[model samples]
Target: MTFNAVTFTVFLVLIAVVTVMGFVASRWRRAKQADRLDEWALGGRTFGPFVTWFLLGGDLYSAYTLIAVPAAIFSMGAFGFYAVPNAIVLYALGFLFLPKLVSLAHKKGYVTLTDFVNDRFGSKALSLAITITGLLATLPYLALQLVGLEVVFGALGIGGSGSWFVRDLPLLIAFGVLAAYTYSAGLRAPALIAFVKDGLTYLVVIAAVIWVPIKLGGFGEIFRKGGAALAGKTTSTLDPAIAVNPSVYLTLALGSGMAFFLYPHAITGVFASRGAKTVRRNMSVLPIYTVLLGFVALLGMMALAMGVKPHDGNPQYAVPQLLSAVFPPWLTGVAYAAIAMSALVPAAIMAIAAGNLVSRNLYRQYRTKPVSAKSETLVSKVVSVLVKVGALVFVLTLDAKFALNFQLLGGIWILQTLPTVLFGLFTKRFADRRALLAGLLVSVVYGTWAAYQVKSATGGPFGGSTAKPFFLDSPIYIAISALALNFAVVVLGSVLARALGAHPRAAGVAEEPVAASN
Candidate 1:
């Protein structure tokens, strides 16, 4: 499937134009303020309802959704539908908690979720813990976006050889643009370009649904062929390890639902909104994509009907393979561009979110006078570049299969921060510092052990399972479970210390006002 030079030219031109538009959106400020962290990092916290919708949606449904979800469906059957419901569960979770978070962020001028945790827990150590957890968890997430773009570029055959430099040139170019605009414009750049990303994605997915059936025989016949290909099973529903019974379904769904909004990158999107109304309105309307997600998942069945095979070394290419077969050379190039740009937008946002954690928490952890707004933003920008470059190395040099597993492991590790964060949002009773550290350690150890046990047969990729008796395969998402352990230890340690009459000084009381920083 060779894309003509004209199609390639149009695709590059489209990306160039959107890149300029993204940089231009940095000027969407409400005031003339130039030095505040809010203005530079959170888009001045002034994104209206529509802008907020696109930004949050783009940030959430990223390259992972564009490529990974459909690919999952293509390879594994109904197990891929987990993405659709995961999205639904996310919105439902967001609806319940985001309004209160928006109100608190507005009143308190909170830029990152760590700000809220630090304030609520009165423990700088715990805040720092959550901050590091977020930044670490986002590494593979950012890499997943790069992997998505790599899939698109490979489909276009942009780089002819499988050589390290050649295969990754498209990733390098996409990352360069992403880093530049994200550095120059901050969150507003991605928030603005999300409009284009979402629009093109919608167009591409809709065309796939409407055109694919006609291109083949019809929906029923397509499934019939798919079923025959898969031994009379059109779509194998549910994962046996994780989705066995009603209890497994409920636990996986509810646990992920709780953890989804708890991620710091997820909070970055929430804070990007101008106000509570913007957040609320977007929450109500974002579920419209459930229909599109359903369509994308069904593409797996289409791939099965068409007997699509995974691309060389990247299982994520199944969706692009199906599309390239269906569309003309010109439109195929357009879809490839959409997928490439899809990864770029989220990779930029994740890099920025992770950088905010380091610049705000780790860099100034020991500073007394406190870091200035300009210094803080500068640290964030520098770290953002370094993180992307690091992820790029992983994409180009390392095995993506292992990298995907590591990302799943990160989910487990990050989930450990949930208790100190989400419950801390409305209460301060459980702010026991020692207990928090203990819980993080316990969950990290257990999750890592479980992930490591997943060794595959024939000395290939590990494929044992994420479940451990009572747990499921998504063990990285057990942050809430880890939080329970953390709280128990904190309570016991706090009690023993009280009996011995030992106590650490209360922290964060002498910090400057939140509004002052902004």
Candidate 2:
């Protein structure tokens, strides 16, 4: 693919503007004690409705929505619509549980999900387990953001066919800019940039939705052409005649919905809000983004209508290629910039959330001496930069499909913690740390084996996250099965530990009542 100077210039300008906004966000709601972990990592726990809405929207919708979701639809047809209900179920689950989580975190001054688990279970080891699981889970998610940016870069013809170093140079530069702003501004960086990321996304997507269909004749013609183009492709069984396997779709929705809040980045966003009501209100409004996602997914079929196959067989570039071919060079630039910024915002937040897990849960727990809150914040900022660098390495060295597959694997691993974190919130019976550990171990081992057995549509083993366990005809999401195994282990382990005379430990700190408003 040849580079487009006009598109590249427009992309650079938008990136420059967003970069400036990221730095300025440090002062958006400047805390007197800005070095405090809560202030640095959670925007002083003071984000109100509007800010919270955008921040959570940015955090959840993600670069994956912009790139991978479309790629999935483009490659797999109707199967990719799984993202739609997955998101809907996520918000529904959030409405039921996020308020309680926000209140609990606020009451306990928790900085990460691990903090809540640590305090609730009164076990540092359990906290460490959650922290490790979070970091591992988040790495691939962060890498997915880089993959999204790479697709945008490829669209602009910046790095599609070059030497390895040349191909990755733009990604490195983008990661550097992201790390610098996030290190300085912390959670506020993404919070501020979410506005631009989402605004440009809405504008570009709405424009494409209207323009692309008309250019392709109409929706009727677009689908007809798309179906014809996808004809005889085994993976392209997209229409009703093909009939999606219900088991795969249902489990994918339920499992992904349950794992949504378990993500450290998602929890970090929830923790940033000012009050329980802020979380609940945001949950109600976040589905607007999901509606946009449904439209975004359609861009795949539109790409098929325009006969836009991605360069180098990378389906992730399908939407970008479609936009570039269909829109003018300048509008295509704006669209690519939106896609790039979508990657940047979430990558920044995920690094911060993972950094918090390391600094607060791992470092603070294992350190020989007491650490100051200021130092903890400082360490986290530094770690955030390193986390981004690590993800950058993953992006450069591995296949982009690995990042997507690992993200699904990540969902499996993160869900294993639910027996401890989510269930522990409601019941004291399963508070035994050993039982939680047993459940986590069982789930991880089983999920990994299941993932390993699945072959990728593109190639290789462990290429996908769905499996047909016990030789069932319909495939089920590995995470759902893993979660079931995790729950069983927790139940049985708890009973055995009780028989062995294990006792629940009390949370050392006092829980205060949280205010109901911002």
Candidate 3:
């Protein structure tokens, strides 16, 4: 795994170019009074169909999608490929609700999901809970991106076999560049860089899907060998199996699809769009990346066919190592660059979203006096830098395997907000603020306890994310089960409150007046 100078050189050049572009992006749209939170955090809601497409696509098909999805396939076989259907259903779900969200956000000047929750229920407490949950969920997700970057560095032979700092020096440097540009350009940085990330990703993936199969004889031969290898394994857990557990598969796909747009980063991307038309167009078009993901997932099968094993216990390295092993140093460099940029673009957006969550929801709530728009944007920029740094620290200290579990756990936490944010959008009955809080607390507690009971290969409770509750036949995704519980609590609690004649304090101010657009 010695570093190839050719590959390393190419990687550095691409990194340098992208870093410069990220900084330059601050001026790309050139919004007047860029100091406002809307301008800085949402790109002034000016992005049209083309830029919105790339931005949201880039946000969704992250390094986690490129690296971790393949890694999951490599390690977990048919179950890991659940990401394919999950992505398709995710867009289908998005098509139904995201445009409405975009319209509401534009009409109300809402920059974060918490703002919507606050306005809908007129409860600062509910808004604060939503804000805290978003920040907590987003941090680990941001760390997962850093883990993706770390995998790239490890694949390049820039790390490992060294002191801790030496191994992590490259990551720190990469994150420093990310933080700087993100602070300067905000959402625009990732929005512009998404073009380059998506282009490189498509080129590398298309080449691998085509070239790797021919090199290995054919798709038929590759699968035959892959199946043989899996069949020889003694353990059911680690061994590759073509059959997916129907219960697990369906829950994961449906639960994750529902939670996709609920993510702050996804909402941030949507809010940046120019209109509902832009949101709808992007939703229709984003599935092309899912097709690309299908091809990328095959890289895991290719690795299996070649009998390539990851150096570490982490399966996340499977795709990166496969690319380095199969492609020339130069093309591998380009591929690594693509994967690295995939990490950067999403990390930047997640940080920005986290920052916005804090500034708009937390910071403003606590302030004694009104915070000017300029002041809010400044605080968000500072907080954005801090968020990236925190993620860098998190990835540096935690096990890479835990990073994946953390992301899954994050899905559980974020999904709890759906009862309030998603359902509250269309109905006032579900707008009971206290019920929202009660549902959120119960779901999180149950999900965390369930996750804690599921032991990991790493030999720790809470180390794995999926668990079955109430002794289901097949394991259910904890998030889905938790969400069901949340909905029940919301409904039952809303009923009891009304039965007692306890009017929600928020009910008086719940509905935002909608003006007719000419």
How many clashes (backbone N, Cα, C below 3 Å) per candidate?
Answer: 6, 0, 0
Clashing pairs in 2: none
Could you give candidate 2's per-residue lDDT for residues 1-518 as a string of tens digits?
66888888998999999999999998888988987998999999999999999998899888778887887777777678888999999999888777887887887799998877766666776777788899999999999999888877777777766698887889888988999999999999999999999999999999999999888899999889888877745653122322367887889888888898889999999999998898988889889888899999999989877888688887888998888888899999899899988999889999999889888987887899999998899889999999898888988888876787788789889988877765656664544677788889889999999888765442564676777776466678888888888888878877787787764443222232233442
Across residues 438-471, which tens digit of lDDT does each residue of candidate 3 receive? 9999999999888877755426646655666785
List the candidates' TM-scores in order. 0.88, 0.94, 0.95
Question: By summed lDDT, which 10 consecutive residues of candidate 3 come out lowest?
Answer: 234-243
Superior by TM-score: candidate 1 or candidate 2: 2
Give the C-alpha miss distance for residue 346 in model 3, angstroms. 0.2
Candidate 2 lDDT trough over 10 residues, lowest sum:
506-515
| Cα shift from native, residue 204, model 2 (Å) | 0.7
Residue lDDT tens for model 1, 1-518? 35567667767877887899778977766347766767777888888888888888788778778777777666656655777777788788787667877777888878788877776656766777777778777898888788777777777768757786775677788888888888888888888888998898899889998999998899999888876765643333223445334444454555555666766677888897877777878889998987888887888888888887767634577778888788876777678777777787788888888888887777765668778888888888898889999998887777776667667666767767665654555443433555666667777676666556554321435332244434443433343445456566656765665565544434222222222112
lDDT of each: 0.72, 0.84, 0.84
Lowest lDDT block of 10, candidate 1: 509-518
